[model samples]
Target chain A: MAAPESGDGNNGAARMVTLISSDNTRFEVEAAAASLSQTLQLTILDGGGGGGDGIPLPNVDSATLSKVLEYCIKHAPAAANGGAPNATAVDRAELERFDNEFVNIDQSVLYSLIMAAHNLEIEGLQSLVAKKVADMIKGKSPMEIRRTLGFPDPTPEEQAEMNAHMLEYGWAYE
Target chain B: MSGTIGVTLEQSRSRTAGPVLPENHVVSEILVRLSAKALLRCRAVCHSWHRRTSEAAFLLVHHRRQPSLPLVTFLAAASSSQSQHSHASLDTLDLRLPPLIGVGWTPLPRLADAALYLHGSSGECHILRCKRRRYGDHGLTTNAPAYHVLTIGSSAEPRRIELASNAPRASTWWFRCSERPGILLHGCLHWALHSSPEKLLMVFDTVTESFRSMPSPITGTQERTQLLEMDNTLAISWMDMCETTMRLWLLQDYETGVWTLSRRIIFPVTEMRSVLNVKWCRFYGTVVSQERYVLLHDSHSSYLFHCDGEGKLVRKFCWSGAVPRPAGHIGSQRASSGMSSSEGNMVLVRGDNHVSFKASRV
Candidate 1:
């Protein structure tokens, strides 16, 4: 569905685009925010996702798409200003606070976001989610990390292998 | 609503099993952000994880992502009770963490009755010890020297290598003289050997476990010469005792042994006049922190002299109070040997009988 007025004609008004989630949910967002995704940037530049023609992201679900859009919207302005060199300390601090809170989500949602971010080629989102995953895995043993990442318990052979590895790299545990 | 939206809205969501396993590339991207110690532990995660983490390409990526802090190892005088023959122990200082608490001192196998000579590069230390054996004219042994290399942190026991064949004949005094610490660059440990009429650079390649000699960048008799690594290149700073002039030379090309004169500084005779007033007073200058600082030690005291990239002295301060003295020997010999990493964050100091390690930033 298209908006009644074409905001593309006016330079003052922010350009808008429609994104279709994998679950077929339609969401409207500003073109600047959507452009943060390298994959969508080229399509948007080529006049795709204009008016009512929504860009379909087949790899991302509606919930994950919404979360990604939230990040893009918040980061777009600062990213446009080239990391906001002139931005006040409070503004930069607020953005950092927002980023810290954004990644604080359920493990399943975080995994979905990582997959979505990778598929969409969103550099910032990919790094952020990847860092979150790394933090969770930090200081955790192999088994603990496997469980944290939702991997199934090791089989007998795999358990034996892990035991051998632990014995060989015993200093790592220390 | 005007333009057509091509995709038809699905009323029901597609059911999926669970979170898909991330691709190896994605996993690598995440793992690269981890610290070296963390990644070492991560090798036990699984077969694929272990293989991926240990790959040379992945290790290079990890090193670039998280550059390792310099590790300093030196020889310290071992306690008398530890061994009846050997006099020294090995100590390691991990500059990546905080000082004092981060320093680890391990008592290695005894040096026996031999004199210990040490040089370290790339966090590995090569220690050479020699004992002279005397032989009488009638087939009785009196004094002949045998050299051995003490391998630290290796699985195998320390073995003896032929020192007479490997060592250059011109610099035989290198074993007896007190010299500056070795500068490690390009996988080779370099130390300046000053022997009266000739000066030679002793290069030990860690990969090949061999020793080679390169001509000194400066020829003729120079009072003091020190080897240092600057911007991944080998650099030498030598002071002419007669003229009290210091010159810094950088090895521009390693293959042809091409050296470019970087800087030359004339000592402020008026400022150092009081300190150098005595006839026997000898001043030793060593490049401590690459091109930033040079440690100058006189017979009685030591001072940290700040210098520019051009080797010009900017300012000087008495460093006796600031520099922590080595644990064992304090006043026996004035000659002190120390080396700093390329980044200058880590420093290892060796005195006559003691060794001290320090890090500026954690």
Candidate 2:
């Protein structure tokens, strides 16, 4: 699929891009938004294939693909708008609020986001997802945390072993 | 075939979708970063994760990432010179390990007064008193005060022991020391001893069964020794003889030769009566914790002293003393000495103000 490029005919602004997902889906995103992914941008630029073929992203599904695009779109504007001429506190506050809302999804979706961000080399998004998952289990008990993480049940002997290990190695004596 | 396909699509649509990341990898990654408290919680969630995290190897790995360094203390009979002895000649216990749990403590080997040194993986402790016998006019003045050492690891076994000093007469003992009443500080056992000459502080290593002398945190300033252990840090409180002013000092890590001067806590000294003669003046004891150290004064008054990562005192609480103290405190009747244990948050012992108690940190 051919990605559409919208820019004034200028030497420095002419850039092309392509994207693909794990399920054989292709996305023809603008170079501006596609460039948000350093991995994809570097790959395309290195290949020197301008306005040619779709970018192959063999890991992301369409649902996650759209979400990544939304983030790229939101972030691209700020980068293109001269870094918001000193981002206002309100603007930062709004961004924080949006990020919180964005991560409010179920753990399954969050896991997908982590994978997509990692595969796409979106460091900021990947860290956000990892931190969010960490925060979710911060205060939870081992059992609740295990259940939340969908861990299997331990056998009686294994439980004993764990308890013994904690007794032997744990530093709770402080 | 078309009807079957439609039914299959409907069934797939109705199923609830869970996150797509492989459960094993994600679970392991988070478990690696969880704190002790959080990990404890995670243990209860399910059997599989609990088993995985409860392994000594896994917990050790986690501990390596974030270790818990505790300050062990001890209590013993004080000597006449007002100085503590080394635990180099006594048995030792190894209290140091990879971080595994929170606030849990393990007792090191305990030794008697006449031992050499104690060394352990966590740290080393030594007896701080010397046998002093004055012989002149009155037959023989046997004024040698007694003291002991409680170390972190078992020193009875053959291990490369580290001695605190490069003194020429470095000796080693084989007998295992009895576990006395005191606290563990920085993995070494600490105790207090009282005698006619003066008070003494005792520390011992459990691993190498060696010992060394612990110098006063307040080196130059002459202060009545009153020690406490908060969290894994040591809080040594004293009153300068010259000014009768109170002060607190912290030993960050004796193994690393780190001694930090904590905030100075001054008490009012009146001229009507000798400040040193006050029996109840030494009733406050402090116990260090993760963020704040609890100070028990007059066997009732509880104050909190906050500390930073460097073990520097940062803040204090001004809550009034609690009524009818939770613990009993009795001073010696005659030239009786008072003692305070920083390990278990024991209240200050009135009367004899020289002897310090080393309670277990757990």
Candidate 3:
């Protein structure tokens, strides 16, 4: 754990700090709030920052990190508010809408999010990303699967083996 | 656009120093996208990936995702004794089984000098046996043997066959049992080895030739034994001690070749006097009707309350109402009707219902 005093002082809320991405771009956020990412949480807890300085994230580039932080900012509040008391019909609909919109992403960004979520121990993000990938590839043939995932073509023998084994699993309905 | 090579000084360095992830990252990315079959193939790609994909839990989870197809039963029969001219006397009743639709009983193949058994489904039959010879007193016999078991009706051919004869030129296939011989069910095979009277049940494999010995799940002190099938699930009924209650056992798992206990259904034992003779009480197979109702009858006119899946008596009526036979008496009925599929249903024989009629169908 690095001491918070080592970081450059940006905002002094005593409970908030700034996160500097790999590109040196900085965003002010509550220290308790930025700890949503398990990776960041450990670093912040060990660093002992009274929210007087900004922490540096060398691995996460500015654009992807900013998108991740935006997700945290929106989700952190509702979770802190103790979630839904009785889960009314309207609350369920609103949460569903928010989840749907939050998961929309391009392929590269989605892949990056999955990797980051896995590294950061973010359960919600990991499931959303894995489910999205599974849904896209379901019912697709091997060739289509390769194309969709940008996988390289297999050798002829490898292709033949796959076809033989998957003979029973192929769905005629699709 | 500015990040392209040679477009700007900063872009050129960025392109040269960019992090290129290893092939494993790509492999991981591809793994989650593969189908169940595709995932299985992914193992041959490398040893590490193969170990991960072949985990039993993973295969079970993957298999659970697929829809469960209707199970097909496979039955095989073979003669137990070496009697050359005599065939084992057996009676096969194709009662109006509801789960099975069409059925007019087809005459099974006559036993040759060799062992013989027949397997059937709906309207089809297949007789599987090893090649054997039947010699005439005139000393006439064929020098060659038949290679395959003849098809009696509609069942598929056996995957393999064996002729266990001792002729110098005879070739036999592999089929072995170290202890007791196995019992063949409608489409499955089972072998029951008894450690004691209490621990008696059978174990069998539906797909493989391997035999498993299992313990019976029935609680003893039951007066009589009854076995019932509800949608491929086997339920056994027996009377508990004191002859005042009936205990029913629903089988839970069949994969391990064991009849696991699922539920224990109890009923207040009904008491009735026998009209013909005051014999001991016994249990028999249940007769389920088209209305999804199960009618359980004991000896004589003693009819008990009818129960559904939940053990609740849906209705109780005089046993004579269902059958025109007189109450408090044992009577035999013998009338064979041409069994049809839809409109013309065959009458089920009750209380020692015997089928002595020959099949009119060839």
Ranking according to TM-score, highest score first: 1, 2, 3
Ranked by lDDT, the better of candidates 1 and 2 is: 1
Per-residue lDDT of B299-336 in model 3, one digit per residue for the tens? 33324335554445554333221211111111111011
Give the docking tier of candidate 1. incorrect
TM-score computed on alpha carbons, candidate 1: 0.55
Off by over 4 Å in 3: A1-14, A47-52, A81-86, A155-158, A161-174, B1-52, B55-362
lDDT (10s digit) by residue, model 2, range A100-160: 8888987767777766776677755765677788787786544445456544444576567
Q: Please, what is the TM-score per model?
A: 0.55, 0.44, 0.41
Better of 2 and 3 by TM-score: 2
Taking chain B only, the TM-score of every model is 0.50, 0.36, 0.33
Top model number, DockQ: 2
Candidate 1 segments whose C-alpha is farther than 4 A from its true place: A1-11, B1-23, B79-362
The prediction achieving the highest lDDT against the true structure is 1
lDDT of 2 at B276: 29
DockQ of each: 0.22, 0.23, 0.07
Instruction: State in Å the error of residue B299, model 2.
Output: 8.6
Top model number, TM-score:
1
Q: Taking chain A by itself, what TM-score does each prediction score?
A: 0.91, 0.76, 0.77
Looking at candidate 3, what is the lDDT of residue A87?
55
